[model samples]
Target: MQRMGGASASLVLFLLSFSAPAAPIPAGFVSWDVTFPGNSGSFDITNQTGPNASTFPDTTFPITTTLHLSGLGLTVHFANGSTVVEPSSYFTLSADGESFNGSPIAIGGTNPLPTSATLTGTFSPVFITLNNGTTQTILSSFSATISPSAGTTLADGDFAIINATTTTVTGTPEPGTWFLTVAGFGTLLGWRKKGLATFRNLLERKGAL
Candidate 1:
């Protein structure tokens, strides 16, 4: 009877700390690079923690994502020491994207991984919507451990979105933003070459490339 009780308690704990793929990002942070015709920059997504923020089951070293929402929140930074905190209606969403490459596995090919592995990507639905009505985006260092239980589809990679914030980043970006933009673009193109995919939504629109 004691063993059964302990088992029940474990299961209950799992249920209480539940987290789902693309469920909704907890109110936290997000950072992304912004690029124009030839110029590029980056900005951070900041917000207030909600009432249940403390209870949100956050996976240690988890991956982050953005949704590129259509309205009510938008911001941008540029290379010429300028920032664009457009009105809420100025935000736009684009469904054009694909998955990134899964982390490199050993060449020898173990049928199943004996231990956990860490992986991250910029194009997967790693972000979640917070109950506080604000979006939670992640920083560049987001990550996760890969185990058999995660799923095969996820074996490919993750997703990302473009977000504009209420605040503005006024500055000439450091070389980091340019480098990150290059990396982001390269990854997106590689996913295309891999025949990953791009979704289309008339509502979100796709003006920026």
Candidate 2:
């Protein structure tokens, strides 16, 4: 019994050592950078300071179609009066297997984040490409490096946001169908109970449980 207890205590200690702290809320966009294979095209992102649309300008990102983005790499820069941050990666988007990515803040806000700290998302849109080796496209998820831009001077009412998905499909279910179905179910139960009660009463007159 002594050996077993000692072994159990040792195992518990080992588990505690390997456990990690909870991840923090992806807070401000102090800085970041994302790089990706060339050929990624222009992608747009939304930026607003508060809940309104006038805080920052809506902008489209630059692209590098070469195998590698060289010295002129993309970046997002952020700074409060006393602090600054930037991204080293790009945010990405895709459809039917094709992709596009960006390395700057997708959306910007003015007040939610301090100039010293801002949130940023970089992306790389993924798509299949053929360079004479084959004649087809197989959309696959590809990494798009993203981060903050170089020389960013964030303002008090400036921020960034990423619209996670752009795909919109619309269809309506049989409108009122579910509500009617639920009502039908209650009707069914009520009728079933009434029939059972009637049968029970008749049985009691004759003889049944």
Q: Candidate 1: global Cα-lDDT?
A: 0.32
Q: Which stretches in model 2 have alpha-carbon errors above 4 Å?
A: 1-172
Q: What total of clashing residue pairs does each candidate reach? A: 16, 75
Per-residue alpha-carbon lDDT of candidate 1 for residues 1-209, written as tens digits (9 for 90 to 100): 45445445554443333321233333333333222212322222322232223433453212233332212333333233344444533322222322111112221222232222332223223234433233333332333332333433222222232221212222233465545445555554554454433433432367543
Q: TM-score for all predictions?
A: 0.21, 0.18
lDDT of each: 0.32, 0.30
- In model 1, the runs with Cα more than 4 Å from the true position are 1-14, 17-70, 91-159, 162-209
Candidate 2 residue lDDT tens string, 50-96: 22222113322211111111112233232433323333334343231
TM-score, cand. 2 vs. native: 0.18
